[model samples]
Target: MITSEKIKIYAHYYGDSDMWARRAKSSEKAILSNDWYLIGSLIQEIELVNKGLASEKFTLNLKKHLIESCDNQETIRQLESLLAMNK
Candidate 1:
């Protein structure tokens, strides 16, 4: 599943409210129990979902890292440009 497809799935699953409620309930139980096993599994599932989504238009694993890096680089560039103008 591409990112867009996963996003659509997420939207549908969340938008309906029923499925979302169930998911929320299960997650809450897991949290309350302090179940690291469940938590770890949930994290892996979310990561898989994200990976599927990002892979469609992005390079999968590096999507978030790249976005963060790009944002950082852009900020630095803008700061340097501003400083140059001030000088």
Candidate 2:
């Protein structure tokens, strides 16, 4: 489980379009570091934002990152459901 502070950090870091490339790079680093918990928090934040206002780019980026980093079937299912809900 990820702490709320970490979740906020992940959201603030990744939510900046000006920093997107850097964010993606950092996400790749997190993936390589095997930080699934942080990844999960990112996904959770994305889901929260998606529920309020959909951003196809952010959704797609998050989905791609989730697919790449997450191995848990349940998490993937939740991602799918979230995607479906936003669509």
Candidate 3:
């Protein structure tokens, strides 16, 4: 599940209600499609970008979640590659 913390990160990154609303709609679509992994990854990436080391482990875990949740082989491969690089 995509958390409020993640949504907050999206909201913060976008920096406007309209943009945030659009993101929220997209997030809802992702959720409905069971593609929450993408949203989770995106949020974690934003958190890492904004907070750096404070979010390193959190981002890594989110990447793991992406690995577990992703159905697309290419996406899983890319995420695995990223996780390996991060390690």
lDDT of 3 by residue, 56-87 (tens): 68767766665566555564444333432323
- Candidate 1 local lDDT, 19-84, one digit each (tens): 554665564433333322322233343355545653543444344433343335443233223222
Best by the TM-score measure: 2
TM-score for predicted model 1 compared with the true structure: 0.23
| Worst 10-residue lDDT window, candidate 2 | 1-10
By lDDT: ranked, best first:
2, 3, 1
Error of 3 at 10 (Å): 15
> Which runs in model 3 stand beyond 4 Å of their true positions?
1-32, 36-54, 76-87
Q: By TM-score, rank the candidates, best first.
A: 2, 3, 1
What are the TM-scores, per candidate, against the unseen true structure? 0.23, 0.37, 0.31
Task: Write down the lDDT that model 3 would get.
Answer: 0.48
Where's the lowest-lDDT run of ten residues in candidate 1? 78-87
Give candidate 2's error at residue 24 in angstroms.
Answer: 30
Model 3 poorest ten-residue lDDT run:
78-87
lDDT of 2 by residue, 10-79 (tens): 3444434345335556654453333434554665657666576657777777767666655555655544
Alpha-carbon RMSD, candidate 3: 9.2
Compared with the true structure, all predictions reach lDDT values of 0.36, 0.50, 0.48
Best candidate according to lDDT? 2
